[model samples]
Target chain A: MITSLSVQWRMDEFCELAGLPAECLIEIVEQGILDPGGQAPEEWLFDAAALAIAKRAARLQRDLEIDWPGIALALSLLDELEQLRAENAMLKRRLGRFLQE
Target chain B: MLEPQGSSMDFKDYYAILGVPDSADDKAIKTAYRKLARKYHPDVSREAGAEEKFKEVAEAYEVLGNAEKRAEYDEVRRYGRAGAGFEVPPGWQRSGSFGDYAGHPGRDFSDFFEAIFGSAGRAGEAPGRGREGGRRGQDVEMELPIFLEDTLADESKKILYQVPQYDSAGRRLADIDKTLNVKIPPGVGDRERIRLKGQGAPGIGGAPNGDLYLVIRLVPHPLFDVEGHNLIITVPLAPWEAALGTKVTLPTLKGKVNLTIPANSQTGQRLRIKGRGLVSKLGTTGDLYALLKVVMPSRNDEATQQLWKQLAEQAGFDPRTEWSKRP
Candidate 1:
């Protein structure tokens, strides 16, 4: 049965979990760095995954002294590399399974 | 003979005080003295009551300084107290007894010196029995720098290092080839230490080896900087693309993705790509953010200039009207 108490989050709740101030969150939203929703800020919502990403972004800026533009480029490149690696691994696994068959 | 007022003078073993054997050569004696002198030096020491210590070291150097006095003192010590029981030696005056020797002011000797030499105020006495196997190896340290990407990728990096190795004869040799495969963990920041266990010198008598530590350093990326897992990309958009909403193809880590730019989008606008960031050990992904920059055409042809003039007259829209009203 689907329970009503299933974990869900709104944009504000996710920002709070990420330990970001409302002003910063607003700036990120206005800049389009984060999409809370397709509509206005009031209607925007985010889940736990978004909140975790936000927290990591905050730490990178605060602790690592990385600027926003640099942070974006780094994240994109690393994501690309990781995706390639994952795909390669998945293919290898599939090939091995086929061989067993 | 009239006895002196003070107590009898005690003998001192100067060779033992300098950490040298009785049969030590001149070179060994000088080396030992230099070491002790540095330890008890006044200028650099912060040890408690070190001023008194300096004076004691000075006094030890004085008697050991003169060869004639050292020889006589050594003879008196070797004879033992029983040898001096009845007859005073030739050239030695009985007029000045051991009690008279105490009348001279005591040097600022430490209790360590006093334990060996306070009773025997004279130098060159062989104090205690000899101790064996006395030498120890020196400790060493080094620093290393590593790339930030290498650390984040958890790659095994081989580092060439030179460490001091001792031969079986205990001679220190240089340029030891110690190749270390450092396993870098993801998220390792600059100046973090990766300790290589049991990689240092083999201790005496097969004791556990010392540790070699590698300090991590991240090389700065030309195009990107890592802040946790998120990546930032500054993309230049055409003026028309910014003015009117359009679907633009953007390069992401995975592949090209179609991104929508809202109408009237301003420069410095940012867009986020979800789950498109650095992969972490926790099986979680970060994000990729793109900042928009509007680039205007530097040179316009006569036809383009005429088209803009016509559009301005027809539209009658002033972009700066809001700014003028701000006062």
Candidate 2:
């Protein structure tokens, strides 16, 4: 079966795919880098987006040597910047549609 | 470029990749690596070819960061390269010590890296694959581009990708091409991924195959723009159509429908058509927003200009009165 947005992974599968330990995942969750569904680690379910972000967090930790808090802040800022850029481009395109060249 | 060159491999200059000097110390090497990594990391960098550049940088740091690897690398450099190819001299012994390295997840260790360090930390070979036996296969990740129209309905896509193959001995073999037909559910957005377990590279010794992740990218639509699940379509109207009420036919993804443009409508105003946008996975449809844009005719004949002059005199309208209260 192809898992869509509705599908999610248990902790074990998430750890396997992300190549991170449970402790690291907990640290990331505590730092607000990942907010997976459910309350406890065992009960939590990680989606594909969370998987991708978890891997990115792992990279930031491994390559940049950044602490959990630092990585969390960086991820938050980077996400906001990406959203703002996409919104800005959409707005610019909309404006262009109305205005003559 | 990292492919095995038999006894000879290209002597990739780690220093050049990091833009550092040959005699650069640990601190200098680190600073250079960090700068390049931050700039070239595909997740963050917006530049073209950032991923390829980051791989070179990361690979360079992998060897140079460790003292043992660096020493071994230096010794090999003494042999010198012959026409872009460096051959390991006879009786070359690798350093027994290996660093504790978990490379960037998707970063494939180049042929040069495997040639030097062996396949212990490369892409497919996990640490104990040979000894343990029945090793799981490598996971594959690829982007699957779908049209905007497809997101509103159940769509099936055909994918062609290559997966790494290995014999029972866990030795590297030629990759085999595979094809899969995937069904995409409605309401999928950009950057979302669909996972297919046990569909990636085949496992060795009957171990379970790895999973495949298909990241979705929505192609831009010519007529509609997506915001969340809602779609926005520009409705261009003539000056008369904007000032006076008019009925016009609008095209929707499903079909064309007649729409009424209210009198005295202004540009940039939106008219929302409910339940006409993209559908959600939970079976809810978003609204379609029709953004109004008013335009003047390209040319006016003498008779039309006279009529416009008469109307301007009679109407006596000031469109920019709000501008007078500027801060």
Top candidate, metric TM-score = 2
The 10-residue segment with the lowest total lDDT in model 2 chain B: B122-131
lDDT of 2 at B51: 86
lDDT of 1 by residue, B170-257 (tens): 3334536677676666655554444454565544434444446555555644333445677555567787888787888877555677
Per-residue error at B54 for model 2, in Å?
1.5
* TM-score of each model, paired residue for residue: 0.39, 0.90
Which sections of candidate 2 miss by over 4 Å?
A: A1-3, A37-39, B1-8, B81-83, B99-107, B121-132, B166-172, B325-327
Instruction: State the C-alpha lDDT per candidate.
Output: 0.53, 0.80
Candidate 1, after superposition: displacement of residue A33 in Å?
38
lDDT of 2 by residue, B246-327 (tens): 9989888899878899999999999998888999878899989999999899999999999999999999999889998897
The DockQ-derived docking category for candidate 1 is incorrect
lDDT of 2 at A77: 92
